[model samples]
Target: MKHLIALATALTLAAASVLFSAANAEANERYGKQKVVYHINYDGGQDDKKYRGARRNIQNHSNAVGAENMDIKVVLHGNGLGLLSQAKTNEALRGQVLELKGQNVAMHVCNNTLKGRKISYENDLFDVFAEDIVPSGVAELSHLQLQGYTYIKP
Candidate 1:
């Protein structure tokens, strides 16, 4: 009787462990393949609340979902480009943006903004790739949504 009871208890424990691990694996998978985009199109210059809010939102969202498990991209155009400009070129904001990028967050700028504003990527921005620049900001947002990326208007 004692041996049988011990065996049953051990089996139950093993079963519980297996179930718990499986559940955890599934939960991780829920965000593992998720694609997200954060939009930054405000024009408040350096003192813009919405611009700051958008940055905070992205940080919070990445924190909530586990940045490593998420495929995240932030699209900047019009005034949203200001955030990157401040973060990249400005000595004060550079560290913050670099830390975010360290967590696999990619920032894409709009080519139209560059052309419209006559901004030179080579002289103006940091950490942006030519390939990452899309033709139009709004159009890129639409295209990303079509590609199944969840858009957050932060």
Candidate 2:
């Protein structure tokens, strides 16, 4: 009976491993070619660790799907503007953003928030351009969803 239980456990583990491998392969092959939008709202990430996890999530997504296979964007609004708020003084954070950009990830900031905060992108954010400003971050996210981009709020 003990041997039977051990064998059962081993088989279950083996089956799980096989299933995981197949799923990972499909992730790398099938839906790797996908467009994804990551949404950020200030309220969710109350601390740096949570925000950093979100950033790491994006990098992991790229790693899983292959950066070239993904057209990714990070959309920030409301208090989420903190995504770039400390960029000037935070070299590590700035470097992470740039690395993702190097992978062709676009970072979108809400123009509405910028206006409300009295920020000029040219002078405020670490590495932002006029093209990166979405008139409304939520609306942009909705539009991207409409256009078949998978939305992830990390």
Candidate 3:
């Protein structure tokens, strides 16, 4: 009976150690590195919930990965352009964008929309750069996914 009790105790300790190690490894993996693409295609006017959710999604993602440990990109296109519209680019939006930028989040606008809507990037966008403009928004999301980026259309 004593030997059996000792064996059981040893087995329990080994199992506990393994479980602890596995949990630690998982935590490390979560913070190591991650890539994600947020797809925003609906106009804020028509889809207020989605727009708000997208911002919340960004915040939640940042919270999840410590913001500093993850790479995030928000791809805006079509009606989604409203989110970054010159008129809509208020202090809150700019602050959020700037904050995310500081956290290494890249915001890419759709060049196709700019061309189709005759929107001047210089006058219409907040802090978007030329290189940040992708050829097509949908295609960009697909490409990012293919490149192992997790897509979140919030």
Best by lDDT: 2
Clashes of each: 0, 1, 0
| Candidate 3 TM-score, true structure as reference | 0.74
Q: Report the C-alpha lDDT of model 1 over 39-139, residue by residue, as the tens digit.
A: 88887354655656766888777765666678888888987777766656466466667877898888888999999998877667776778778899899
Give me the overall lDDT of model 1. Answer: 0.78
**Least accurate 10 contiguous residues by lDDT in model 2:** 42-51
Candidate 2 residue runs with Cα over 4 Å from true position? 1-27, 43-47
Query: Over 4 Å off in model 3, which ranges?
Result: 1-32, 46-50, 86-89
lDDT of 3 by residue, 35-142 (tens): 899998887664354566678789877776666567888999998887777334466666766777888888888989999999877788788788889999989999
> How well does each candidate superpose onto the true structure, as a TM-score?
0.73, 0.78, 0.74
Q: lDDT by residue for model 2 over 1-154, one digit each (tens)?
A: 9999999999999999999888778888776588999998864344566668888999998878877789998899987777787666678778888888999999999999999989888887788898999999999999999999999988
What residue pairs clash in candidate 1, if any at all? none
TM-score of 1: 0.73
Question: Scored by Cα lDDT, where does model 2 land?
Answer: 0.85
Query: Whose lDDT is higher: candidate 1's or candidate 2's?
Result: 2
Give candidate 1 misplaced runs (Cα > 4 Å). Answer: 1-32, 44-48
